[model samples]
Target: MQKELLKWLKDVGELDSARLISECSVDLLYVDTLFEMSSDRMTDLMDAQIGIPGKYYLKLQLDFQKEIKIIETQLMEVATALGMHIRSISWNPKIDTDKEVQMKISIIVRQAIFDEITLNKISWSGRLEEPDFLNRIFDLSKMPSFDSRFDNAYDDIHKHRIMNYDWEDDWVFTDRRFNLLHCEEEIFLKFLSLTINPVSRTDDEGVGQLIEIYNRNLSESGIEFYEKSKIAGKPIYGYREIAAGNASTSSADAKQRKIALVVGCSQYEFAGLLENPLNDAVAIKQNLESLGFDVMYAENPNLKDLKIKIDDFGTELEKYDVGLFYFAGHGVQVKGLNYLIPVDANLKSERTVEYDCVQVDRILSHMENAKTSVNLIILDACRNNPFERSWGRDLSQRGFAVMDAPKGSLIAYSTSPGKTASDGEGKNGLYTGELIAEIKSVNLTITQLFQKVRKAVMEKSKDTQVPWESTSLTADFYFNRK
Candidate 1:
């Protein structure tokens, strides 16, 4: 879904940042310190009236009705669909931000845009003259926009809103002449969903043919589509990876010194217990050590021990040219910052986040202090613990926030930002399993290694989990280089 649309509201004065979370709720931050307000601005804010979700603003009853309306207007401009709504505007009365601190403005959009739009992912790029998939599945000639004889003003007006106007080209044969052969990944998946949807097309025959065609040609690429579920005897489809990993014995040469800190937290006291992290860590440690890394491994460490190990890892990293750190456990993003939960973490509520868990930024800071030339931070810590949702509707985000890899470093997440990766049924989690196998490849750069792992994870998890990376490394790195 178009989560980026919420940014338009930032144009409204005094808005510091806007975030869209899992529940489709929009949380806005209004920092009093960042920008200057009018001399009587605080007085006006105190006098304002917020009509919808009661008149509570930072321990004071302030009428913010005027400000809320502007935000709602901006929401309408971005969300084109009919279902989106501003269910309520909630501000906790306990917070007293009067002393020039950031004001948290909470807004709930029921049946949020992202929730409404769920698209299955399958990768494909064809070399055909026309989109053969579309030719076989759809009869676009039936659409009103198909005819080139008429120039409708309404259609013209709609076309101009987009950056490139040849979209869904009903008339001339531009790149859009074919059905989604040339389109954004989102649009492509949307079209693919429509093709297999029981309501969209009653004919199961076309869906069958499409799957057969896809698999026959895409087998070498390791992609396959299959029936995920059935609706009233009609089939619903999803795709998965179908290939095996190639084995490699060669490890990185000893020209450059390398060290790795690997931590896996599986054992837990009450909640957030995971199955495969311990196994994942052991496997990674073996792999890194074989590849000439001085591995400092920890499994099921409590909060105190986890911090001590990380600190020590940083201190010892000074002797190495390239350093790597990997964690496999429960992780959450409170507000926008990421926290890696130790096995002993008792995350009861939002307030306990800072005290109970380790901030990923702190780890980055430790790495920065060492001044390591090349650093890699791999986190396979995004298993959606049941307690995370039980705590509160809006509290405890699902996964890690996308972070910029520090200079000379690359940050690889087990799953994409704002999404959780699957805790696997096998010895390791779905992401770490792929990562373990892919790192064995010779001469593949750190960037290439992660991309291959991302593809494998997407295939294995049926697009539910895709790994992500942010890199700023100047030189190439590998497990085994030529």
Candidate 2:
């Protein structure tokens, strides 16, 4: 059975070499496997040995990081036919000082099938015997019966991974396996059943139909497989074209209609001046413009000017599907209400803040009343409150107050509520600098973009500062898409 399986794997180009090693009583199977293409140089050394009377140890070492879930799925089918139950699987990175990193996967299995005559004599000195039925399982003629579309699909996925290698921090080996299983569920299920239960009613016609359905679903999902399959001269199903059309429509909708209002107050009359607000605003304006937004930028705006700009922004929002508002400067919260301080505001007491500063609620009202489909409010204004000492009240808060996002809107704070964010020694603040970098990541969705920004800020601040957000958006939004 082992020999036949090894031969079939070799014939199918799944492995580069296979050998049976006799080190002890039981025969050990060692195979060198390859994935995608030979040029990738990703090799796996699989060692299968019976360590105990009924238990088996399977150790796999890969020369480079790649998906092993497919291998695991195949092995599970093999074990099920042999009446073996997998106990556990573990993964570890084996690092060498002189060489690149290698990933090691170890799996333990225990046998459940018991025939007294066949089981009692299974010892440590000879090869474990397999029943005649088990030995006939690996029929070479049945190998090509499995769907071939999976080969192309997986190749496309691998190529996509290679193309995005530098920016894909989230696409780990685990993610690849997950996408494979979810994206090609029917094909994999049919393959597994055919391999393990050959006597079942699986036919070529049925398998072909399953492959067709799988192909249709993959195309509709807008996954890498669909794009690659098109280049390979394969016919795309109906739903894929529909999905592609919808995507095109969305892109056209966003092209010239997205709007953003950026306000940065650096010079204050009563509050201390900040050096980074103007620079942050300029950088943000450039980034948004690059992403195809009509930006309204303001620097050193007073209370009256801020109100007029925000009101104008509200009027502009009515004609757009996406609206974004960004503010960078002094901010404070009194009595649990957040306010953005202008450059010319003079807050004599807590009572004066209501009339002197811009209320965050009012800004949100502009977005809500404009009826935009998506609204993004970014506040890089959570610096230390400069008027806290002069308030003569218990208004000694560190930063802005926490507020809930209205429906279809997302509000992001420079730092956690009530926590002061850093104005970096560099030209831009910590949060905004990280945000600027992440916004330019073409493939990331808005949520993913913010997650990367949060991670960067935390790491750069050494855990001293953390960004926070409140979101009620029902649909996904991306700054840049490909």
Using TM-score as the measure, the top candidate is 2
- C-alpha lDDT (0 to 100) for residue 409 of candidate 2: 91
| Every candidate's CA RMSD | 25.3, 19.6
TM-score of each: 0.50, 0.54
Q: Please give the range of 10 consecutive residues that has the lowest summed lDDT in model 1.
A: 42-51
- How many clashes would you count in candidate 1? 5
Per-residue lDDT of 19-77 in model 1, one digit per residue for the tens?
21111333322211122265532210111112222223332334445555554555554
lDDT agreement with native, every candidate: 0.61, 0.60
Model 2 has an lDDT value of 0.60
* lDDT, candidate 2, at 226: 21
Show pairs that collide, candidate 1.
48-63, 49-63, 49-64, 50-64, 241-459
Q: Deviation in angstroms for 11 in model 2?
A: 24
Pairs of residues at least 3 apart in sequence or in different chains that clash in candidate 2: 25-124, 25-125, 25-126
Candidate 2: regions farther than 4 A off: 1-250, 392-396
How many pairs of residues collide in each model? 5, 3
